[model samples]
Target: MGTRQTAIRRGTNLPRMGDFNESVVLDAIRRVPGGLSRVELAESTGLSAQTVSNICRRLLDHGLALETGKKSFGSGKPRTLLRVNAEARFAVGVHLDPAVITYVVLDLLGNVVAHLRVPTPPVADPEQTLSGLSESIRQLIEESGVPADRLLGLGIAAPGPVDVAAGLVVDPPELEGWGRVPLRDYLAEETGLPVVMDKDVIAAAIAERWAGAAAHSGNFLFFYLGTGSGMGLVVEDTVLRGVSGNAGEVGGLGAACTTRGMVDEAIHLGVLSHDFTPIGPRDAERSLAELCRLAAEGNATAGDIIDRQAVRVGRGVCAAATLVDAELIVFGGPIWPHVADRFLRIVPALVEKSPFVKSLHPTRVTSTEVGDDVGAVGAACLVLDRTLSAQPQSLLLA
Candidate 1:
């Protein structure tokens, strides 16, 4: 039998040859708030005037951009200002947490048009959970009033060690039935739209650079603390996608923080055991709530747990900084708000005490300022960034 080849479609775009030029122009216009004139676009992109004008005409015709107004300076002619038409396109972002699911619809401007959250289906049944997710997406589209035809695609942020090359989620015990699942295939078919997937933290890092606090931060790290620890990196203004798309799975770094009769692993407070039961599975969501409740009541055990986990997280940050020299480090995930504020304070202290990082320079550590929607918003930004952001790496192709 002939081999069945599957093609992953990441939305549609211009042919490869000319897309490079179009992408460059689009990126420049997106960066400028007041928009740029033909001359300005040509100057910024290093394209000839005729080329910029041609590309501009194409973008405007496609509704990706519009003539906002005209500008004049000195003896220069009043040049027509062009700006991106944010409403021209939209993207759907879904964050598939083990305990909770978050969905958001974003216009081209990275604004959340609408968002909703619901309890995630049990991980034991992939088909049923995915069906529920698909229906939720349809409901979102209907409620948000976003034209389905204008959607770029659906982007999913999930726990990783994902085989992104083939769109498979690998061995996430948190997602019980997701062992090597062809998630993109199932979701794309279910939702009737193209799908892109990445680790939740990685998506959060992209969101910051696209629309959050780190819009201008090119080299930074995002430390994700939710059900557990995860990390994402940005080097030279691009999110690092390492082999298998799981470059920053540093949760194991907390091994040193494990306690006996807990995870048989790290002693960090993130290890959630019901009724002090050792070796039993933990409910991360309930653990989070419990930890917060106890900590608020001045429970030293819960407070100490958070501190120890932050130390491990800081050590991981030091490792990344020494290896790649990240300039900024941002923290996000549901866990941050609950216990990581104390974690955040302790992280910097630990980092400063480290000989490696202190010898080079102190890496800036901060929590995400994007609110509770960091993961979901990042997922939406992933679609926009992949489709429109300037992708210089494509030049490596023949």
Candidate 2:
């Protein structure tokens, strides 16, 4: 028998090289809202003048960048300025919470073109839930009227314990009956687009970095309060996803601050009647909302329940902020809107009083600027970040 020899082809670096350079140039233009000149792009990205010109030409031709106007600097020739064409590309984001699933279509500039919120089906069957989610996404995109070709991809912000590598949603505490569902791959196949997944808190943090409260701050902590609770840590402008892609799990802090925990506590303390006992994620939210109403109406017991939770949250965030040396702490999630007024009043003081936080640098405490739908917005940002944003990790070989 004759043995056939197989030739192994060596991989070339040219394929990713142009993409990386283009991303760098695009990122530079995006940073300057008013726009940047080709000279400025060359200077900022450390690319050659010809390379910048070539990239800018490609960007303009692709409708990703536009020549906004012209500017002259110190007797130099008038330089044409280029800015990102926000409408040129779009991304879909789905935030899968236990109580509700939020869907949003965002333009390249991170502006929401359209959005919808639907109560999550109460069924424990993952297939049924997945079908509903897929349909909702399709409806949203169709109703929004965005060109399918312009859509970069879909992103999902799910609860913690997500296996990001495998694109699976592990057994999240709040999302029952979803055991190791291949969310990313399923969505990618269903939507005919690339899909990315991250923890909801992490996604929220990325959202803030992209367009919300942390837009100006490189180091910050996003304290997310929803059906459950957790923190998203960004240090030195890099989001920290540990070895397992679950870096922000608060463990006990999350248990102590969950909406369900608060509702249960209210019931046990007689602040809320047994009839108010939560039967599901939405029930917990409703009960918590009622508790907030009672507290606002001068019910001391209800107020105390919320206040104590504030204290616990405050302590947890302060420790995290100090640990990561974050300069800003943003709080938001579905449940945050219900408790923002209360949390702001208490958490800020605790942060200001922390010796480490106060003595080193002022840690600004604020709510999310991305609104209550930050998770959804962040989900979209995952696509934007992956496709557009220039990161050092992209240079590493697979």
Candidate 3:
């Protein structure tokens, strides 16, 4: 194959020689919210005026940016103002859960142009779910009137213990009976697009970093509080996937809390059910919610149970913060609303007293706005980011 053909096959979007300069220019434009004129772009990019003009012309011709207005000052010639045309490109996000499957179509600006939610397809056959997912995506694309070329790709956020590097999902506790499924390859084949797979919690963290609570900050933790709790860590804008890609499994940490006599306290407080069936973070949230409702109605049993659960959760958070050295912690998933108030009031104290954290140092804890769609949105953003920047590390489609 020729060099251009070879580059395309390799999935490298830019030619080797001038890719850095092109990326720098694009990033500069992205940073400028209202976009920059040619002259202003020159100043911001540190390129010569002629170079900026050339780049702007090329970008405009490529439809990456649009001329929106004209700016004139000091009676000089009016310069055309530019802005990112988010609709120029698009991405799709899928959140696959045991109970529901959510699909969202997002433009480059992270705006949802379309969305679909339905009961999860039967897992006994596996193909049933995949086919349903494919049909749903096709319906969304057809209804949206978005061209096939503009459809960047799809992102899948699934239950965890995923081998992200291999694009496979291992045996997930909640999603039992699904043996190491080739989710990335299957979804890509079904949609005729590239599909990226990630743990639900990790994807939520990515969405928060891009469009929600942690939009500007780094070194934060995203706790996806569901039937199971999953954690995603971000250090300096990159999601930290540990050696095994299972970095933030906090359920195991509860065993450590047992040493502190918190387990019995949890059961006694009714935050944990006396029922022997295995429970997870979602169960904790459910218990907390029940307690909160009772507390709202002036039930002492509910109030005390919630208070005890808050302490246990705080212990876990403090442990994670100390180990990861996270500067901020964000909570999302089903349990957040139930425990947000209690967590906000109690976690700080527990973290402050912990030996792991530095004396007098504070870790900012907050709730996430992305909610359940965090995974889907983050997945879409993942593809879009790769498409725009063409970075080797952030591959969206295979």
Question: How far is 201's C-alpha from truth in model 2 (Å)?
Answer: 1.0
* Residue lDDT tens for model 2, 1-398: 01111111111134556777888788667766888888877666667788889888999999999999899888979989999999999999999999999999999888999999999888877898899889999999999999999999999999989999999999988777888999999888888889999999999999998878877677899999998888999886679999999988877675657898899899999999999998899999999999999999999999999999999999999899989988899999999999999999999999999875757678999999999999999999999988987665667867
Give the candidate number with the greatest lDDT: 2
List ranges where model 2 is wrong by over 4 Å.
Answer: 1-17, 46-50, 72-78
Return whichever of 2 and 3 wins on TM-score. 2
Better of 1 and 3 by TM-score: 1
| Candidate 2 clash pair list | none
What lDDT does the true structure give each of the candidates?
0.75, 0.87, 0.69
Q: How do all the candidates rank in terms of TM-score, highest first?
A: 2, 1, 3
Q: Which candidate is the best by TM-score?
A: 2
How are the candidates ranked when ordered by lDDT, highest leading? Answer: 2, 1, 3
Which residues of candidate 3, in runs, are more than 4 Å off?
1-17, 20-28, 36-55, 70-81, 121-123, 255-291, 322-325, 348-362, 389-398
> What would the TM-scores of all predictions be?
0.83, 0.91, 0.77
Candidate 3 per-residue lDDT over residues 1-398, each given as its tens digit: 01111111122223342443444455455545566677766555456676656666777897878888887856999888777778888999998876567888888767788888887653555777778888998898888888899888998888888898898888866564678888899889888998887788888887886667776465788877655667888875567878877677777646422212333344566654666123443344444455567676876765665566667777777777877777778888655666577667887777777787755557887888676667778778777665665343543333
Q: For every model in order, what is the number of clashing pairs?
A: 7, 0, 2
- State, as a TM-score between 0 and 1, how close model 1 is to the true structure: 0.83
